[model samples]
Target chain A: MTTIADPKAPRPPKPRPARLTTRGNTELYGWVFMRASGVVLLVLIFGHLFVNLVAGEGVTAIDFGFVAGKWASPFWQVWDLLMLWLAMIHGTNGVRTIINDYAERDGVRLALKSALYLAFVLVVVLGTLVIFTFDPCPSGSPADLLPSFCTA
Target chain B: MPDALPASATRKVPAGTLYRGREGMWSWVAHRVTGVAIFFFLLVHVLDTSLVRISPEAYNDVIATYKNPIMGLGEAGLVAAIVFHAYNGIRIILVDFWSKGPKYQRVMLWVVMGLFVVTMAGFLPRHLMHVFGGE
Candidate 1:
């Protein structure tokens, strides 16, 4: 039998083999996530655009009252929440892969990825908070501008 | 990847253009470009949207900028990028998952482009009317 030395076999500590793939399935999952999230994002974003820019007065109708009316409903709130999370995650991962590819230097890649991740965290957190904690109608505000739902 | 070519490779091939393959490579490039553009816009958009928490006036004031003609044109372009990215993304998913995807990838790219044109055609006229309809 040919002697096949096991890489993980315990022996005297020697130089670790070059190009050892310690990252098992991480890249694979990232690839799969991109496609999966992408499929859903196409639907979510298309609907979002259609509603916000195609229906009603289109872009002209988008205002504080417009946003307030939509978010007031649990349905749209959940809808936006899903859109926010999925879009951010998908965009962040795509950017991260690009940074890894183009930023050749180790320090450069690290710095770029750090900035990318920071933006991801900041955007995701802020969006989530804004969606859930949003007060559609503040007290002592412009009554005329407020959505009718606020009066009710 | 910088290693030697295969045994049949005796001819001197052009360098630095390997990444610039035909339809597949260009589509990949477009995907990356659109993805990056959309990502930056999303960051700005999220920040603009977060202003809603500050006050209603703050939010409306910012969103009003988005209704101007210049921004209206920009929105059209953004929608174009989004439509292309969305359709191409579906094409990529099909290529990865479908059994007959590779055989028909070129056909699917055409399909993607076709869908993109039809979608933008539907969106642009109405959106431009809203923006420039002087309402």
Candidate 2:
């Protein structure tokens, strides 16, 4: 004969104690870095935008000459360099979090994260190089192709 | 006596319980929203800026499209999202690391909001001036 449980019975013990999955404080630091970088990025990003798109003649004013003019100043160079590095790293970490949450298979997660990290490094390196190494007035270029300032 | 059914199988969470608009819950939601927004913006921004390498005229032409008044308004919204996300993100970090953080999370959130307001107050006027000021 089957016996039914009483409604007034006490609860049973849990299966096992929960163990932490994350190692040391790495994830903790990652969490903190997200916040710190985010704060800095707001300033860097907005300043870059204001100067580029709104200052002077607004977006229509942006061109090779405009960028060359801005980068000519060491201030804008550093401003842009900080913005590029912080944003890329912050964004990569954010996506890593997303992948951890959504990706079920370990192999898939590893592959995706590896690809993401590779893209992060590629873009950051290339963008940094472009910002610093850009030459508005290269010798031997067709005069017609260069910005007016280069000739002046 | 027969064993009782597992709590997971028998218990039901009410819809209201799931939908309760707690402060921490909303903060998490905003974080995800802002993170995604910035990620997408970065993709388009990088692609557009890379146009500079192709030709100056191409880069300038692409950037010219951003001059629309409508886009200016959108930029304001984007700034607000970034500010909130950044401020709240700091609060989250504190809660994870600070000794007294979990106990004072609500207080920290207000502090973050206050800082956000101050920062926006300083930046918005200049930004608005530039946006509305004629070329």
Candidate 3:
């Protein structure tokens, strides 16, 4: 019996030595970010959940006053600041990977990434400002709605 | 798996669209769009919440401002932003680390969309009620 062979067939080539370049290695750096950020996110996110939800009186204990109490100290403020920065960087890098994969045109990719970077800067700056500048106990706040600690 | 095209085979083809540089595959593109949206939301949210630290009057003023119809809509937009950012972040994590990541991008996309819909559907009603207040 004769067997039929397919037309338009491809024959595989023997492997050749791979070239290494800075550009080729830059991709390695991005891959590193995915792993590194994933690890850090695991810690930062879980720590946030633990402090906000599990510590003290649990979920019911959270409210405006609770938030005010935490921000009353610089330590909690810095803790939250670190969390914000890490999560934003982690989340942004993850999305940047996605954009490069799907955005077909150079112009489209440039536009999208430019927008992403701008927004990232804006948030990080604004969030850091808020955390550092926050004054949870303003003297002039209304006695009724203000946290009790504010009056003292 | 065509053998490396002979120079002769490639030479005669009319130029198709010039290949763009910095080609991102697919998932990276989605990741970026969600990242930017979430970042913008974070900026506004932090700024708004920061008012609470200024004074109770200022905080109440900001909250009351959000009750305005346009601001109410903006809050809903924020909910959407967070949902997309979180869902896409999870997708990236799964794809990069797990053996199944490459295989599951399409399914993950659908899952993200579905969760986005459900989250907004649940969140918007409560938000609207808060903004509009009871009859």
Which of the numbered candidates is closest to the native, going by highest DockQ? 1
Going through the candidates in the order shown, the clash numbers are 0, 0, 14
**Largest lDDT belongs to which candidate?**
1
Candidate 1 lDDT tens digits, B1-135: 547877457555434655758899999999999999999999999999899899888998888777789999999999999999999998888888899998888899999999999999999999999999844
Which of the predicted structures, 2 or 3, would earn the higher TM-score when compared with the native? Answer: 2
Write the residue-wise lDDT of candidate 2 on A47-130 in tens digits.
776676556665556666777777767888798888888999999999899999879799999999999888888788778887
Off by over 4 Å in 2: A1-29, A39-43, A53-61, A105-115, A138-149, B1-20, B93-101, B114-135
Tens-digit lDDT string for candidate 1 (A63-125): 889989999899999988998999999999999989987887899999999998999999999
Query: Lowest summed-lDDT stretch of 10 residues in model 3 chain A?
Result: A53-62
Best by TM-score: 1
Superior candidate under lDDT, 1 versus 2: 1
Chain B TM, per prediction = 0.85, 0.83, 0.69
Worst 10 residues of 2 chain A by lDDT: A53-62
Reference contacts reproduced by model 3? 0.26
Which residue pairs collide in model 1, if any?
Answer: none
- Reference-based TM-score, model 2: 0.71
**iRMSD values, candidates in order:** 0.7, 3.3, 5.8
Candidate 2 accuracy as lDDT: 0.77
